[model samples]
Target: TPLHLNKVRDPDDQLVLLPHGLLRHHCCYPGCPEFLRDLRTENDLDAADAGKAGDVSESTRRNGLWQHLSPKTWYYARRSDAFLVPRVHRIARGVMDEAQTLHHFVDLTMRKLEEELRGRPAYAEIQEPWLKECVTALYGEYLGIMGV
Candidate 1:
């Protein structure tokens, strides 16, 4: 069957359709085999180039042209900060399973912030505080504690 990318929800889900590349969450149960095998019984899928179909990078770059080039030039640093903290927190807990410590969470959050900040200059300035807040929220929480 030709699985279209539109049918799949996300990249990881798309990756699962490839030969033996399914992402599995380890239960880490001492009794269970080192890792329990996650069986995929369905056949829906996507092509390898699904993510490259759109001009995502170009679109982001174009959108960034209007942003401030430096943090000092930003009029709403606090507003950007406010928007970032909770968004990152929710994203970290939801995506990373809240497995890492706060320090680790913050570090990862910063990395993601930088990635998003990849716009020219203004986006970076705005992303810094939001990433920091995200890390703080996720750092101490244990797995399953995220309740995301």
Candidate 2:
């Protein structure tokens, strides 16, 4: 689910305000393990790829074009969530039995993560439109997995 990227040239990404029902606060426990795991998932294949039947180098290139040209790109396979989610996980471990306690922190962390994503170095440097789609699409997939 790519965001409406053509909506405007607004400096801000077109992140819509969710209806109240779609918010994580409506969940039984915000920041639950399922939500966290979804954030860590790296399984977004493009629709144009015919569910990954496309060229391997395409995915390879999408996975490759990022900061430092390394797997340390934080959202790529084997690299997903490496820098962002672990700290939250560490703190949330103590409150596992009371996962709701994480709602606020989870919310903050997610917003900050989005901010970081939008601010990522060379995140949109690719002149080709389709090749540059991964960052937002994968982020959108995680949001969907989180059921928001």
Best by TM-score: 1
- Tally clashes: model 2: 0
Error of 1 at 145 (Å): 6.0
Kindly provide the TM-score of model 1 when superposed on the true structure, using C-alpha atoms: 0.32
Highest lDDT against the true fold, candidate: 1
**Over the stretch 1-148, how does candidate 2's per-residue lDDT look in tens digits?**
2144326424322222232112111111223333211121133234215437865654433221222224333343223222222222233222233334335434443444444446555334223233224233333434454565
Per-residue lDDT of 49-72 in model 1, one digit per residue for the tens? Answer: 332566444322211212221232
TM-score of each: 0.32, 0.20
lDDT of each: 0.37, 0.32
Task: Please list the residue runs of candidate 1 whose C-alpha ends up more than 4 Å from where it truly belongs after superposition.
Answer: 1-81, 85-91, 120-122, 126-131, 138-148
Which stretches of candidate 2 lie above 4 Å from their native place? 1-69, 72-100, 121-148
